[model samples]
Target: MEVKSNLLIQMDILGLIQANILTPVVLFFLLGLVAARIKSDLKMPDAISEFLPIYLLAAIGLHGGLEMRNTGFDSMLIPMLTAIGLSLVFTLNHYQILRRLGKFNIFDSYALASTYGAVGAVTFSVGLSFLKNQDVASEGYLTAVLAVLEPVSFILAIFLTNLAVSKQIKSKKKSLSSDLGNNEKILGMVDQSKTNLSGVLRESITGKAIIVLLGSIIIGYAIGDKGFESISIVFDGLFTGAIAIFLLEMGIIAGQRLDDIKKVGVFLVIFSILIPTFNGIIGVFVATALGLSLGGAVMFGLLMASASFIAAPAVLRHAIPQAKPSLYITSALGVTFPYNIIILLPIMFSVSSIVHNVDGSINLFNYFGIDL
Candidate 1:
């Protein structure tokens, strides 16, 4: 039964991905990419381009905020903490893997790691839509998880980078300890102070993307249901269109960055695909332990698999200016994001379904003596 069920779930998820891929939102993104490749002069006006992400993030955050208002925090404390903790772990581990496997310098590795570690709100939004389309119910509070996780990987990544930088200073200058040079010691102090956790916290949380996302979440929470419903005309009704436009912009950017694929190469590309799967499986176990519904488990895994192109870039612009934009951006949006959206979501949902069902069957047999 387990094996048969697993096979059926895989087929079902593939069907779902195929069906959802044709939506206006995804289609617009494809359109933008094609237009860019053909050089048809398709471009978002700079003013409007700047406005779209804000609108989409606000819309998505408000939705999650509304959900949080619907579901109070006391009941969600365990899973919420689980989600946040796992996200942090994923970010830190991602940096380690990037450095180990990809040999990326401290700055670039951490930057890319943060990019992967952070959840992609857009991808999460789409995952929600996927669940909705299948009429699969998920916990509303997962949106809150998305909001809280947006800045986690970036901060953790920065911390990782700082740790590495400090270590490199000590390793390369181990002699400085015996030399007793006041000048060298003073410089070392400055470097260690630069890696201070407080500084990373500030820079990571202060990025425009983080600020906007968290701010929207707060505003959404404060407004509550009644207030949100009042503004649903703009935030709710037009949310899809805003996302379509945002993705259109993203598609163009991805196309422009395609040439950088050679820079990413095989090892990093392979790393991009695997890291999400690794973290996503960990998320599954965590969510499962939290007693989330099957759909909730898949959503958790989706958030795990997804990488933040928007938030990471916004923060990394300042945090790791030395990191190549193409390396991280292209890897996140071009490789990891696409892989998660196209392939990983369904696989996650299928795995969650299997676990949920197998668990249900075990409980049934234990309680009622019916195994079939």
Candidate 2:
């Protein structure tokens, strides 16, 4: 298992920058930071930014579902399951590893776990863009995996944290019951401490992203090979354009949060990059094992290896309030995410190509999903 150091990896990344697709994402992100730093009026409108993610989720899901339809159930089902399950397992594993680095206790662990586990849609989109730009082929079905992975990780983290919270409550039962009975006012107040993990899991399962992705998947599958031709000309054609605008908006948002990023410090910042870097590396191995193409493997690796700032943080706010959102949010959004999108993806592609060479052939039947 000797990893080669090939110059092709460098070339691919440099080419991406030269192509001008990724640079804008990076530069606009920087611009947002600068704008926020200087307090400039230039800002991504709140409504637009909010809608941008929804558009991205919908587009990615539709594209993936349509692609999956072309591939048929046999090609997609296994990989989709593999992607979601791995996403859940690895996210929690990363949280356990990350716990030692910060002051994160069990509650904080759940919050951070979900954050590290989930993949950011923007980052995944960047990987897709890179693969397309290089003329490398990948499964559109993988997008369904991406959609599934995001919410499941959040659900798992909540379950783990709630279990811990429940244990703590049990330990204090006698005293806690007395205190609860004495405080009539507090008893009537909203039970912020209550951890209805099951309910939360149900909600996350039926979340907006999942709903759109599932609905579109059904539509795409029903349409079969035609691939929503009538509507795709509008939605599919404008997909990339929409993505660019969204990234620009994301850049603005990231820029606005730059000041808060400074509080994250050297160690956390290093971990942010390294964790995803590590995840990407592991993803290469997983993709290789799964027998995916160079393109599909890299994309899959990137998805598994990515961290979620969007869905995870939103869940953490409700599930683990004591955990500092700043640490998780800033780390994912400000650090690992951008690094993965700009640099890691190309490097991953090269790794995938090298691995595929071990037994060079088109193995389109297998992909990132574990079952596949």
Q: Which has the greatest TM-score?
A: 2
Superposition-based RMSD of candidate 2 using all C-alpha atoms, in angstroms? 4.9
TM-score of 2: 0.84
Residue 286 displacement in candidate 1 (angstroms): 2.6
User: How much lDDT does candidate 2 score?
Assistant: 0.71
**Over 4 Å off in model 1, which ranges?**
1-11, 171-197, 358-372
Local lDDT at 281 for model 2: 73
Computed on alpha carbons, the lDDT of every model, listed in order, comes to 0.75, 0.71
- Give the root-mean-square deviation of each candidate in angstroms: 4.6, 4.9
Clashes of each: 0, 5
Q: Which lDDT tens digits does candidate 1 get at residues 223-318? A: 998887789999877877777787788788877777788788888889889999888877775676667767788888888888888777767876
